[model samples]
Structure formats: structure tokens, C-alpha cells
Target: MTQYIGRFAPSPSGPLHFGSLMAALGSYFQAKSQQGQWLVRVEDLDPPREQLGAADSILRTLENYQLHWDGNVVYQSHRHDLYQTQIEQWLSSGEAYYCQCTRKQIKAMGGFYNGHCKPLNHQDPAGCAVRLHIDQPVTEFTDLKHGQITLPQALAEEDFIIKRRDGLYAYNLAVVLDDIDQGVTEVVRGADLIEPTGRQMSLYHQLKQPTVSYLHLPLALDENGNKLSKQNHAPAIDELDTQATLLRAMDCLGFAIEPSLKDGTIEEIIQWGVQHWSISQLPESTEITPRFSNGSV
Candidate 1:
């Protein structure tokens, strides 16, 4: 049997919150349950949004919770050359083209790119963003938790940007390339990214790379049904109370913890969690209210 490999890639825009913990614990438990390798990748692609010390703080938070990874953490910022190499290959092969359309122009065209720049054959790649001319559309993929997911045909056919005009690699391009390069067999992340699955799968086909399995866990939402994220000002997890935080995160994942394990160490809790981890047992809803200690709910 082929060994399983999973990863948890998080942006270092802010400190780790309950939602982030849920994704970390979910991916960690899923990988460890199968005795597979679990790796962490710091997705610091967009430097403008990254906090001063959020990357180090996130690593420290993971360590405090005993969610140790299998290898040294991978950072996307140091991988511009790798991404650029693939971009150049696609451009040379006519698989991708340069785009000069601004966001405001696309919004004016009913919020979807109309492939305005595909016919231009723009040669100046310095200021223009690169877009993949998607000939084959990825309509559907079976998610482990959500089963068959069919994306809108228009969305599947739209030419998406691979590199931004700001000279930064787009998330879709970088993530797909990284996953392929890292040999990741399975991707376990939050359901908020479900919409991007089809695009990434399409990229896999375009690059002639095998698509990885996907299992998007339910998102942690606040009282107003907003996702718990740095943009929403979600409080960071308290490392000092790792035990409680872990238990709460497990509970959010629909794991029924025994009262006896209330006082267990992080290791003990993780061992128990791996033993009982079940993707099929996860909540069916995509959004779930996370129970926090500060009575924020």
C-alpha cells in the first residue's frame, strides 16, 4: 500500500485562532491516524498582508499544542524561482498568456474575466499578470466529506490569473505547484476553500500531474455566521491553555471526548484523537460555530 502524505498550509497573516487550530488538528489527526507523514507549509506568498512575526508565532503555537510536523516547515516566499520557472514554461508553450485587465475592468464585465487579454498576445510580462487559458474545465470532484461537487460551468471555463500584476504568484498557481512538488497525496483544509478545488484540479490536468485527494473540514464561524479569521478579528488561541484549546478544537470537529481525558496531556489527547479520527463522522454542515472560552458566542 502506498504511504499517505498530508499537509496543513496556513497563511501567516495573523496569529493562530480557533478556526486555524481546527484545520491543524483535523489535518494532523487525519495523517497521524493512518500513520502517514504530516507536513506544515507557511504560505507567506503575499508579503504585504503578512504580519511582522506571525510566521514564527504560528510555528510556536503549533509546537505549544504538540502538533509537531514531520519535516522542516516550507515557506512560499523563498520559492519564487520555482514558481517563475513553471510560469515561463506555460507561457512558452502557449498554455498561459499575459493579462493587462485590472480588477475594476473584470468587475465591470459582470465579475468574471472575459478572456479580454487572451487575444492581445501581450509580450510585455513585466507589469502584466499571467493567466492560464483553461481549455479543459474541471466540473466536478468527489470531496471526501462533501461527496460529489459540481462547480458552475462558467466558473470552470473562466481564464484565471496564475500570477498577479503586483508581481506575486497567485494562490491557485502557487498552491497547486507546491502540492505537486511536495508529493502531497491528500489535502485536508477548511471548507471555505472548496470553491478553488476545481481550479486546482484543472491545473493538475494542465500540468499533467496527478490530482491529490481532498477532504475539506467544516469551517468555524462566529455568532454572525462569519468565518473566524484574522480579517474578522478572531482571537488567537491561548497557548498557556493548550489542553482546553485542544479539547475545544476536537469538540468542534465532532469528536466525542471522554470526561476522563479532560486532564490528559497534549500527547495523550492527540493519541486518543488519532485513534478515533473519522472523516465520515465529521459534521455535514460546512459552517459550525466554534465554542470559545470567553463567551464570544
Candidate 2:
């Protein structure tokens, strides 16, 4: 049987919160339940949004919860050369091209990039972003939890940027390449990223790599039904109360643990969680308001 390899990648924009913990624990349990390898990747691609010590803080927080990864942590910031090589290959082969269109221009056109610069064939690549020519867009894929997902034709056909004008690699390009490079067989992340799945799957086909199985866990929301995120000022999980945090995360993921385990150690809670983890139990909706005892993470 082929070994299952899953990953929990988080951006270092802030420390791990209850929402982030749900993704982490869900992925970890999913990987461990099958006796597969679980990996961690710090997506520190956008330096401007990354906090100075958030990366290390995330790692320490993971350790505190005993959600240890199988191998060395992969940092996207250190993999620019790899992304650059792929970008060059695509550009030389005409699979991708330079685009000078700004965000404002795209927004004016009903928010879909119309591939205006594809035929430009401009010699000057300076100050331009690299966009993949979506000759054959991916319109559908099956999610492990949500089943078949169909993407809009316009969204799939848009010539999405693979590299930004600021010279930073795009998330879609980097994530697809990284997953392929790491031999990842499954992707377990938040439903907030479900919209980009088709684009990433398209990139997988472009790279001639098989797309991996995906399971987008329901997003955790606050009382106002807003998704918990660093941008939304979600409180960071307290590593000091690792057990409580893990239990709370497990509950949010739809795992039923005994009340007796509330005071249990991290190991005890995790063991129960992994043994009982079931994607079937996850809520069908894309977002869920998580109930926390302390009112916050």
C-alpha cells in the first residue's frame, strides 16, 4: 500500500490560535490515524506580513501541544531558488508569461483577469508579474469531506499570477510545487482555502504531477460569525494550557471526548483524538462558531 503523507502548513503572521489549532490537530490526527507521516511547513513567503518571532513561536506552540512533525520543518522563504527555477521553465516553454496588469485593472474588469497581456509578447519582463496561461483549467475535484466541488468556468480560466510584481512567488505556485516536492499525498487545511483548490490543481496538471487528496476542515468562527484569523485579531492559543487547548480544538473538530479527559495531559487527549478521528463527523457547513469555555483561545 502507498504510504499516506499529510501536512499542516501555517503562515507565521501570528501565533497559533484555536482556529489554527483546529487545522493543526485535524491534520495531525488524520495523518497519525493512518500511521502516516505528518509534516509542518512554515509559509513565510510574504515577509511584509510576517512577525519577527512568530515562526519560532508557532513551532514552540506545536511542541507544547505535542503535535510534533515527522521530519525537519520546511520553510518556503528558503525555497525561492526552487520556485524561480520552475518559473523560468514555465516562461521559456510559453506555459507562462509576464503580465503588467495591476490589481486595480483586474478589479475594473469585474474581478476576473481577462488575459489582456497574454498576447502582448512584451520583451521587457521588468516590473511584471508572471502568470500561467490557463489553456486547460481545472473545473472540478473531489474533497474528502465535502465530496465533489465544481469551480466556475471564469475562475478556472483566468490567467492567475504565479509570481507577484514585487518578486515574491505566488501562493498557488509555491504550494503546488512544495506539495509535489515533499511527496505530499493529502492536503488537510481550512475551508477558507477551498476556493483556490481548483487553481492549485491546475498547477499540478501544468507541472505534470498528480493532484493530492484534499480535505478542507470547517473554519472556526467567532460569535459574530467571522472566521477566526490573525487578521481578525483571534486570540493566540495559550501553550501553558496545552491540554485544555487541545481538548477545545478536538471538540471544535467534532470529536467527542469524555469530560474526564478535560484535565488529562496533552498525550492523553491526542491519543483519544487520533483514535476516534473521523471526517464523517465533521460538519457539512463551511463555517462553524466554536464554543470556548474561557470565551477566547
Candidate 3:
């Protein structure tokens, strides 16, 4: 069997914290153990949230942690032309339509676009966006960790927007395009993304693209039980203790790591970890906030 190809795509909204390490290490080891090529891509498509010095700092942090990736880094911001081409293609094929619905209107309509603009013959004026037409999404798929998951009837039937009304390509569109372009055979990331995977899979069917395997690892949450995100003010990982941090992340993934190796080198420890990497040991599918093992140590 051919080896898998996986990627860790982090947005430069803020520097990586321990939560980020969990996803990176999880995906990294999965790819490495399978003799697959692991790649890194900067999801800088969302410009407003992007930090000025964060991208370079992020690369530096990855280097410090020895989470090196293969090949040239794919920057989403630099690929706007490709996105525009696809968006225009979808529009021309009548697969997408123009929408001018404001957030306030959607809020008043009980959330989600009520297809208010779906029948509009109006052209996309400046600042307007396009939305993909969706039929009742009754599609079912299997997830690697969470087992046979089923989406709600209402959620499956919602006509999702592919391009945002803000003149920016929506996440669903970009993620599908990027993954398709990169030939991604496997998607290993945090479980917070599990909900979106079904929608992306739908788009794959629409575009006639191959679907990739998904493994959504347990999310790293904060004291508030919210996922540790840069937006939630999760402090960046302490680069000075990258190896220790990686070890702690491993523990969060449900490994009974030995104490003697807690302070070992990142590579040395990761090699040992790959030998013991057992996906079956992961906790039940639920939100989990990561806690550095002061107790485990």
C-alpha cells in the first residue's frame, strides 16, 4: 500500500500554544509511523486575524520543536487566483449564486441563511458574495476516531455558503480546494473540525474529487472548557520547553508515558512514542481541555 500524505495547516492568527502542539504532534507521528510525507501549510487566507510577525515566528517555533515538514510551504493568501478561478467556475456552472444577506438579517431569521437571496436575479454588486446551492444533505460518512457519526436532519439539509458575503472565500470552499490541490490523502487534525468534515465531503462529491481519510484528535481546551485557541487567549507554547510540552501533549492523547522519558529530546521521545502510538487508546469523543501533567510527572 502507498504511504499516506497528511498536513498540519495552522493559521497565523497567533503563535501556537500547547493545543496546537497536540494536533501537530498527533498528525506528525501518524504520518511518520506510516512512512507518509507530512506537510505544513499556512492557512493565512483570513487576513484580518493574521498577525504581522506571527508566520515567521510560527516557523521558528516549529523548527525549535523539530516539527519539520516536507516540501515548500503552501500559503493560502498567495493562492487567491486559484480560488477565484474555481469560484468563477462554480458560478458559471450555476452551482453557486449571489447573496447579499446581512448578518443582522440572518440573526433575525433564526440564524443561518434562510435562502432569502436564493431566488434573487440580482447580480453580485461590489461587496456582495456567492453561495453554493445545497439540496437536503442526507449524505452519511465514517470518521476514524468518533466511529459512525450521523448529522442532524436539519443540519444535513442546510444550504451552506461556499463563498462569504464579505467578498472572502468561505472556509468550506478554501479547505476543499486546498486539500484537493495538495493531493491530501489523509486529514489529521483536532476534533473541533469533525462537524465540518461532512460538509467538506459533500463538496468533494460535488466537485468529483477523491475523499480523504479523517482523524480528528481530541481538542485541547482551557480551564473554561473552551478549546484552547489563540482567540481565547491561550498563551503560546513555551518554546524553551518544547520537548516537555510535546510529552504533555502526548499524555493528553491518552498515553501512559513513562516518567524517565519526560525530559528527553523531542526526536528521541517521539520515536519511542511512535512505537507505542495507539489510536484505540484515545478518549471517548468529547471535548477535553489539556492539562500539563504535573500530576503524571
Each candidate: what lDDT? Answer: 0.91, 0.91, 0.80
| Predicted candidate 3 versus true structure: per-residue lDDT over 1-297, tens digit per residue | 756889999999988877788888889888888888989999887788888988888888888878789999898888888888987897788777787878898788877677777777557457677777776363566778787777765566567777776667778888889988988899999887877877888788778887888888988877667778888888888877667777778888888889888768887888887788877877785567666555221
Give the distance in Å from residue 180's predicted Cα in candidate 2 to where it truly belongs.
0.5
Off by over 4 Å in 3: 136-139, 293-297
TM per candidate comes to: 0.97, 0.98, 0.93
Which residue pairs clash in candidate 3? 221-289
lDDT of 2 by residue, 125-209 (tens): 8999999998889999999998999989899999899999999999999999999999999999999998899999999888888
Worst 10 residues of 1 by lDDT: 288-297
Tell me model 3's lDDT, rounded to 2 decimals. 0.80
What's the CA error at residue 57 for candidate 2, in Å?
A: 0.2
Error of 2 at 123 (Å): 1.9
Model 2 clash pairs are none
* Model 2 lDDT on a 0 to 1 scale: 0.91
Give all candidate RMSDs, comma-separated.
1.1, 1.0, 2.2
